[model samples]
Target chain A: MSRELTVVGLSHHTAPVEVRERLAAAAADAEAFLRRLVADCGVDEAVLLSTCNRIEVVTCSKAGHDPRQALTRLMVELSGIGAHDGDGLLFAMQGREAVRHVFRVASSLDSMIVGEPQILGQMKQQFEVSSSLEAAGPVLVRVFHKSFSVAKRVRTETGIASRSVSVAATAVDLASRIFETLDGRVVMLLGAGDTGETAARHFMAANVGQIMVANRTFETAVDLARELSATALPLERFRQYLPLADLVVGSAGGGQLLDAEDVREVLRERRGRPMFFIDLAVPRNFDPAINQLDGAYLYDIDDLAAVVEDNLGERRREAVRAETIVEAEVDQFWQWFEKLQVVPTIVELREYADSIRRGEVEKTLAKMQAISEEDRERIHQMTRAIVNKLLHHPTAVLKGEGSPTEESRLLSAVRRLFRLGDDT
Target chain B: MHTHTLMLFVASACYIGASLCYGASFSRREAPGARLAPWLLALGFGIHTLDIVRDVVSAGVLPVATFAGGFSFFAWLVVGIYLGLQARLSLAVVGALVSPLAFLAVTLDAIVRGDDVAVPQALRSPWLPVHVTLAFLGNAVFALAFAVSAVYLLQENLIKSRHTAGLIRRLPPLEKLDRLSAGFLMWGFPLLTLGIVSGGVWSANSTGHFWTGEPREILAALTWLLYAGLLQLRLLGGLHGRRAARWTIVAFSLLLTSYVAVNLLRLGTRHGLGLAG
Candidate 1:
């Protein structure tokens, strides 16, 4: 009997965050849970993945047992929830559907924020835990590695991961586009609004030359600056820093902070070097008319949102390409799996032939002790070659070199004919 | 009609093919085309090098001594420098612009301009090859700078207009282009200075005066001064981005017109305005 590979889980797609959070397993509990499935549930192979978004148990059952009920029972018991609690919340997929589901999960196709990259790493962490606990056997090992390559293929072949989807990323993208690089370029963060801090962090990560965070409250500015390892300035004196700033991000509260005249004065000080301004505030901080200046570019929150939306659309289109890659990989992996199915029978046939040859050669050698040692060796070699020749066609058939039906039929016939037994 | 000419033609065809691949890669935003483009350029460069060597061997003179030879040498240097930059930096997008420039240079070099003059005995010093080679190499690097600057300006416009998709996505970052152009200009400026100095020395030895105001000589001097000023501005004034890029483009244009186009035109003038002497 062929063992079944199954995955039973609850994800953000089918359950609320409250349910997902309750179902999530701590790191220590995850390993123990995988151990329980193998020790008590008659599972030959097991892997448990627990994340903020989902908790899934993947397993391959032993020959005579079905693991679905055991997995469901374990999940209910572990979460302290009734079996019928979140009716229709637990999804169960078996066989090829299970494989495809795992691939999608690993590639971030099924992520809450589609195209987000965290899911792949989360899956890898789960696999590592399963591996350390000795729960991942041949089947889970093959499937998990294939899932990683499928995710990488999706990333490179398609632009599914193209463009930044957040306001901070959009600001950084705009800054890079305008100035070409942030290296040796000064950035001034106007106000310590959350959005401003996020964008400033992005600039810091990009290795911008320097960052000066100015706020109306001097202590907040100083605190944020210390956190980011940047310079803090008083809001009143922010204009002094603007002349040296190649890029400026404004997320301060309330009225216009810099008018057109102020920008003009700064531009004169900068000698007309290009400056990009990303205004991430409500009611706007920079003068809208600063865009009219020759070397000045200003974008507000709405502009950044439009860019993010456009990128999300592009990512959706690229997701279609990513889906095609996933499908092709699934087909490739399925073929490998089908070939894996015949491996045990083929190994049985080779061992059966070799054992008979070795037995007959030992008997013949014992009786021919009066003959020379060279002739005795020759007899052994001759019998080994004949056994190999006799078994070559049967080995090929058992290994699925022929049609699938023919291969399976021949495999059964050979097993019975050689009395190789059902243990294989 | 000769084997080297035929080989040069083949190299031009390869460059044209590489240009199309890079163009398709940019428009389609696909990886296969971008991956194939650089290999095609490297192949063309190899064949182009062989073609130049064949000409130098058969003619018993440096390949930069004639109009067709000079352009071919310049094209070879452009592709050579471009391949180096491509290896060090991700410059497949720049290839879309550069591959065509190389093709044009090679095609012009293959045109058989019908005025093949011999090198004068007085002008046949060892410095002749060094001066011409350095000049062409400097010009080749500047041409690359021009391509990068053009891409930079295009990318800048896209960002300013708030349309940062498609072609803009294909380009290298704005800062990378700025730095790349500046680096090339800085390296080329000194070689250009040496080329000018050596050319002056060669001219004085042959014609007895280094300050003659021939039109080509004056134009060459002006091109050199413009690039010198651009470099100084970048070093002292933090001159970069749009202004530095614009000046690099202008200086390269002047170099092309005075160095290649004027020589090809071969106009009848009072000072005999050509490099043949």
Candidate 2:
């Protein structure tokens, strides 16, 4: 019998966070759930993937049983939600759709933030858990392994994950556009606002030469500097170090700290080296007119957000290319799976032919008691060869080269023609 | 057609093809033809080099003696230097900017058709090749600087305007472009100074005068002074980025105008190559 793959899950797309949290199982609990699913839920193999954004129960069942109804019931019970509520939240997919779902999830195409890297790791962890519990059979193992490689192909072949999508990341991206490498470049944080601190941390990660924290409150500056391993300076003395900064992020709450004239003086002192100013302040710390300075570039919070939006749009376009890759891979995997489905029908046909051949040979030998033992053995061998030759063409048509649709059709036709029971 | 002309045509076709590929790679989100463009450019440069060598061998002189040969040699040097720098820098967009200029220069060479000009009696000296080569090399370096500075301004405008989109990522950083432009100026200034000095000595030996006060000589001197001033301001006053880029464009425009006016139009008494004759 062919085993069918099925998935019943709720993701951020279908379920609210409150419902997902209730359905989300711990690692040990998920393993026990897989055990129960395989042992008593009419599932031959099962894996439960639970993350903060989603909870999916992937199962392999024999062709005769519909495990979806049983699995959905268990999920509703697990969530402690009403049956009607669970029906709206959980999505059920079987056969090729299930395979595609697994691939898309592993590739992060189905992620809340598309092209994020954490989904594939989370899937692999759950797959390993199921395998160690012996709840994952050959089919689940092959499907999970293929999903990993598909995710890798999607990552390398497409630009889905190449651009930065967050505000802090967008600031780094803009910084790189202005400067060649951040290796020896300096970044100054003016006021130690939360958003500015986040952007500074990103620059630090990019290996900026040094980070300076200057705030109106000197102690606050010192505290942030200690945490970030940077130098702290009083706000009054920040002008002394302004010329050294390649990137200056302003999060100070006060209005218009640096005017156009002040920045022009700084540019002259630095010898016209470019300075990128990210203004994350609410009331605007740097003068907007500073952007007009020849070597000074100013981007406020709204500008940074606009860049992030643009990057997200680019990622959406790349995701279209990634979806095409996933579709092709799914077709390839389904062909292999359909070929596996033909194996059982071929075995059943061979067994039926051999049984008839053995019965005819025995009956004939009983009637030929006057003949020698050598003649009897020769007769049995002759019957066996005739049966094998007659069955070869039928078996080859069922098992040999054809499309998945053609193979499945041939499998059922051969099964019925040979009177092979579907039970096996 | 002669093999020399046929090779030039083929090389020009390769450059055009490379430029289109680079344009496609730059304008699109995906860099599909980025790898193919370098190979196409290298092939064109190789064929152009061979064509120049053939001309030098057959004529028994460096190919800069005629207007056509000088234009072709200038294009060859530009492509050669760009290819060399492209090996080390991630500046593929510069190729898109440069290869079209090369194609245009080659096309200008074909139009002038000055390949059959005989070497003048006064010009038959070892100093002719030396002076022309140094001048052309400096001009080529400045041409590359011109393209780099153009890119720097484009990138700077995009960053300042907050339109960081598809084409900006393909371009090198502004600081790198600024630094490269300055480096080109520093190198080209000396070669140009030497070229002017050698031209003076050659003129004294051939015409019994060191200074001609001709239109071409004056323009060349003016071009040299402009570059010298720009380089001095860059080195000492720390003038870089947008202003430096604008100065480079202005200087190159002057150099290009002088070449077209004095060489192609035959405006000056000396250094015209006598294409009309």
Candidate 3:
């Protein structure tokens, strides 16, 4: 039977945001689930791929059965949720299409963010899990290795990975606009939440003059400030220094602490110099009226979302181009897979034909004891020619048909015609 | 005297070996040249050490109480420090360019000695070693800077003119060569300062001006100021790659010309050949 690969899963495209987030596997959890895939699931070879935006399982089987049902059932059992909840979220691709999906994913040509180097490392982890479980055979080893080379090509040959702009990076760009040089500017980093902490770190790397943290809880803010080697002051003290700061990025853990009147008082002291304000908080902390202040640049979460959306669109266009390259590469992989199926038949045909030629030629030579050395050499050359001439047509036909055709018919024909299997 | 002849022959061979190794390195652009560079450097250094040892042994004392003696002492001191730096930095490729100048200086030393020159008793003082050693080491550092700056200038010109080929690949990156040149300046400037100070101390009691006129002092000061300015620009202006490279070449050229001009003036032509005590 011909073996074919199958990828059966939904991703950010097919599923809703909520569904994708729930189905996605964290790096640590994907390994255990990968083992169960081959052990209890109907998978001969498998790799589990999980990232922030998508979760997919790719498998290969000779049985030609739809592995999706088995995989979704496996997902349901692992998740401990009702199978119906994930039933509508499933997507499937078979044979060559499955290989194309895997190549695209490994190359980061299918990620929500194209040319992001992180996905390559994630796919490598999945491959690592499969290898550790002894689930990846020679076929997957070939596919996984080729994926790295294809990824390297897309990275070097295209400008997709160069000069990338991310959200954190955009913040740095915006900061440069406000300050002539970070050589001597002070910042009031209003929160030390994960995103806020990350933004603070970026500010520090740019060599911001100094940073002051103001959070709802003074202790937590102080702790983060000390960790960053920045100073922390009270919430009430924030207004006193707001106008003194060159930049104010308020990711205030929660709630509006700065009003229109409050910012007006702050702006009054700020002079004519520009002050950059980024509110990453959900319920925008700064008054909407504060944005109208002269020399004040304010951006909220929605503005950042707009920037991310624009970038995502650009990412998709390059991803489409990359996808075309990956599809061609995957076709090459399938051709190699196909040739693998034709191997035993080719071997049996050549070996069986050669043995018959050897047996007859030897018997004829032995029967004539007066056969000269010249006659013996002539017989050897003739026997090789006869074998080649007889086997040439069938070998070409067998190798070309390879795996798309049902393999059993060809195997049986080789056995009966040559009586090959009986001797083995 | 025969040992002296043997010393000159061996030192010349060392220079030849170092030049051959460097030429090989630049041509082949491979490990054999880089590997041979250090060995050839060691061979040159070994012969140089033996030559110096034979000189002292043959003379009963350190050979130059005469102008010939000072020349030989300064020559070995310059080349000796250079060979030490080669061992330290593994810059035998640089030694290729320097070794010939070294051989020439030593040959000049031999010629001056063979002329049966008189020993200026005033020149032979406890201060002589300090003044000569510091001056020689300073020159050695300037020589290193000169070689690196020349390489930097060539690499920059090649890249700017968009002509890259085998030699460019063999050379270290521009930033590395620039830093190496700048590092030489940092080292040489202080040694130069000490040499000037010692020379001043030696000349303090003597009458009208010093043994040399104000021009050597002025030129040395000019070189020091240029290097100091270049180093400051490298640090504060964050100047790097080609801009910093060009400055290094300019500074090193000024430095080298100062030494050459001072030496020529010492040999006394129509040019002032200025004064003597």
* Per-residue lDDT of candidate 3, residues A97-200 (tens digit): 77777777778777676778888887787788777877787777787888877887777555455423566656665555334457667878887787788888
Task: List candidate 3 segments past 4 Å from native.
Answer: A13-15, A22-43, A63-104, A128-135, A145-164, A167-197, A203-211, A214-230, A234-339, A344-393, A396-424, B1-186, B197-210, B221-277
TM-score, candidate number 1: 0.82
Measured with C-alpha atoms, the lDDT of residue B272 in candidate 1 is 34
Question: What TM-scores result for chain A when each predicted structure is judged separately against the true chain A?
Answer: 0.80, 0.83, 0.60
Q: Cα RMSD (Å) per model? A: 8.2, 4.3, 13.4
The C-alpha local distance difference test score for the whole of candidate 3 amounts to 0.66
For TM-score, candidate 2 versus 3, the one ahead is 2
Question: Candidate 1 DockQ category?
Answer: acceptable
True contacts recovered per prediction: 0.31, 0.82, 0.00
Q: Candidate 1: give the TM-score of chain A.
A: 0.80
Clashes of 2: 0
Per-residue lDDT over A1-424 for candidate 2, one digit per residue giving the tens place of the 0 to 100 score: 6677899988899999888888884334866787777766798888888999999888888865778888888888888789988878999999889999999999999999999999999899888988998888999999999999999999988888878899888899888998999997899999976887899999999999999999999999999999999999999999999999999999997787899999999999998989999888889989999999998999998999898888899789889999999999999998888788788767767887889999988887888769988988898889889988998898778757887777767776775676565564
TM-score of each: 0.82, 0.88, 0.47
Give the Cα error of residue A379 in candidate 1, in Å. Answer: 38
Better of 2 and 3 by lDDT: 2
The DockQ-based CAPRI class assigned to model 2 is: medium
Candidate 1 clashes between residue pairs 3 or more apart in a chain or in different chains: A180-B174, A180-B175, A181-B175
Stretches > 4 Å off in candidate 1 = A25-28, A63-65, A178-186, A207-210, A226-230, A271-274, A292-295, A342-424, B28-30, B64-66, B111-127, B193-212, B259-261, B269-277
Off by over 4 Å in 2: A18-25, A28-48, A69-85, A124-138, A348-394, A403-405, A408-424, B108-117, B271-277
